[model samples]
Target: MIILYDISCTRHNTAWSPSTWKTRYVLNYKGLSYRTEWVEFADIEALSIKHGFAPSGKRADGSPRYTLPAIYDESTGAKIADSSLIADYLEATYLDTPSLYPHNTRALQAAYEAAVLAHLDAIHQFTAPYLMTKKYFTPKTEEYYRKFREPAFGGKRLEDLLPFGAERVKQWERLKNDIGKIAAWYDKNDRKGSFLLGETPSWADFVAASFLVWLRVIWGEESEEWKDLETWHNGRWKKLFAAVKKYEAMA
Candidate 1:
């Protein structure tokens, strides 16, 4: 069995981090047996250190930065951090299961993931404020998140990052337009499929879907923003989300 580490959220105990969602999608799609271990934002670094999990990245000061979406593979006694690395480990270890990178498309899939994330800047900016709300995070985690992220936004209060009214509307429009650009990429697909590579589901789809899932989780399905998103680009996002919805199981 595998122990997948995920960032905890206050809403329904669901896994909400987009990075972690990528791993969850891979695990579920491959039919792997795993259980989620929810960790508070404040504890991620300590947890990583305790388990000897590799740092996910580096901080601005070049200090090692630890994050969740890590995994402990009980079967192999392997502890891995970072979503992409976890996917690679799983792909290499589970030969019998379906591959996330099929037909030697690992490089292409990695590029696609980077491309998709590059276009998500507006979405990230627009959603940051909502993510800081007390409704989304526990007390301690929220405090940690705010302290850790406020500096990035020039020390502005989370709500001030994108205030409501005209500014918020402008940011939302930017997000929608950015999403349209990504949708145009799907339009170039020569065949009809919910995935990036024609009829085959791969890591590329998981990467794209994770952002959509992030949007849905942060905005709430019933929010006007999410509803608007569902109708955009001829409902392509909605369909893509539906196709991968089954793989959203947390465990």
Candidate 2:
């Protein structure tokens, strides 16, 4: 069995973190037996270091990296960090499970993953204000989140970025423009199929779905943003969301 380190949200019913969703999706999609360990933001560095993984990456000031969405495989004594590496590791280690990466398409799959992740910063910018202010967080997690994120926001308070009233509408419009790029790409290449690559839900599907899944995690399924996304690119986002639904953890 493997242990997945997930970000904890003590006050929210939905236990999710955007970056971690990719790994969890792969684990569940492959029917791998694993249990999630809830980790707060403050503890990720120490926990990751203890698991024998390197720091996640360098800080803006060249500090050591420490982040979550890491996995410790008790079965093989392998500890992996980073979602892309984890997905590749799982596919290679579990040959009997369904393959997420197509044969000889590792490069393409990586490109697809990159394409989807390209929008991550914008999505986070659109959602972070609401996510930080209203969503679940223990006091420690909240404190750590602010400290870690403030630098990225040009030293502006997270709450200060929240748009309201007319500004909120404008924010949504801008977000839609960013999402439109993705939707347009899908529309051009989908070839009228549900999945990005025709019938199968490949890594491309998982990568694309992870974005909206993160949104759904932060905002409830019934949120206006979720509903609005459903209508994008002729319901393509909605279709992708539905395609991955079966892979989600069963209640």
Candidate 3:
């Protein structure tokens, strides 16, 4: 059996967070059995140490990798580091079931799926700074949920993360606006149905939508607080959410 450590609550979204969702989705899609490992700041150190995921390169220099969505396959004693890599690895190893990335590379469909993967990756990186705020970050005073400077009022506190600070808040608002653009793109592109690929769920259907789930969390789901997002989510992304909910219940 393979081991999948879906690192949630890491305070950051970089570590294949949504990839974890998609990896799990593909696991179900392929009918492969695996276990999930969840984490927050208190336990992250222990989890990384136990699993040899201790930040080595830049992490040793006081900067952290801050990436999750780790995949450990004890069966072959191999650990996969990145999220998208995990997706490709799984599809290649398990050739028996419905192909996640179509086997036919000659066709434009396969090319298009690869393009979607790259596009989602680019989108996440391009928008990461805006997507999350200090809310997701743990406190600096303690191991988790720490606070830094006052929101934008104090300009002297550079070391501390200003939760409500001007820069962070501005970036957050910008993210909201940026997402509106993304939503426009979604409306223009995905007006067909829940799945990006129409009818059947594809890798894009599962993975791209996973980030969307996070975006909604930050924005709110069908709540008046973010009525625009809520309406869009309730109307369009409902099917993706439904798929995740249904798959989770299988256990």
Deviating ranges (above 4 Å) for candidate 1:
none
Instruction: Arrange candidates, best TM-score first.
Output: 1, 2, 3
Q: Could you estimate the TM-score for every candidate?
A: 0.96, 0.92, 0.59
lDDT of 1 at 70: 94
Measured with C-alpha atoms, the lDDT of residue 138 in candidate 1 is 78
Worst 10 residues of 3 by lDDT: 144-153
How many clashes (backbone N, Cα, C below 3 Å) per candidate? Answer: 0, 1, 12
**Every model: Cα RMSD to truth:** 1.3, 1.9, 6.9
What's the true lDDT of residue 241 in model 2? 78
Better of 1 and 2 by lDDT: 1
Candidate 3 wrongly placed segments (more than 4 Å): 8-16, 42-66, 103-193, 216-222, 225-227, 248-251
**Residue range 112-217, candidate 1, lDDT tens digits:** 8788888887775767778776367778987988888788778888876765688878887888888898899888997988888877789988988988898888
Question: What is the per-residue lDDT of model 2 for residues 207-246, given as tens digits with 9 covering 90 to 100?
Answer: 7777778788777788887888788777878888777887
Q: What is the C-alpha lDDT of each candidate?
A: 0.87, 0.78, 0.53
Model 2 / residue 16 / CA error / Å = 2.4
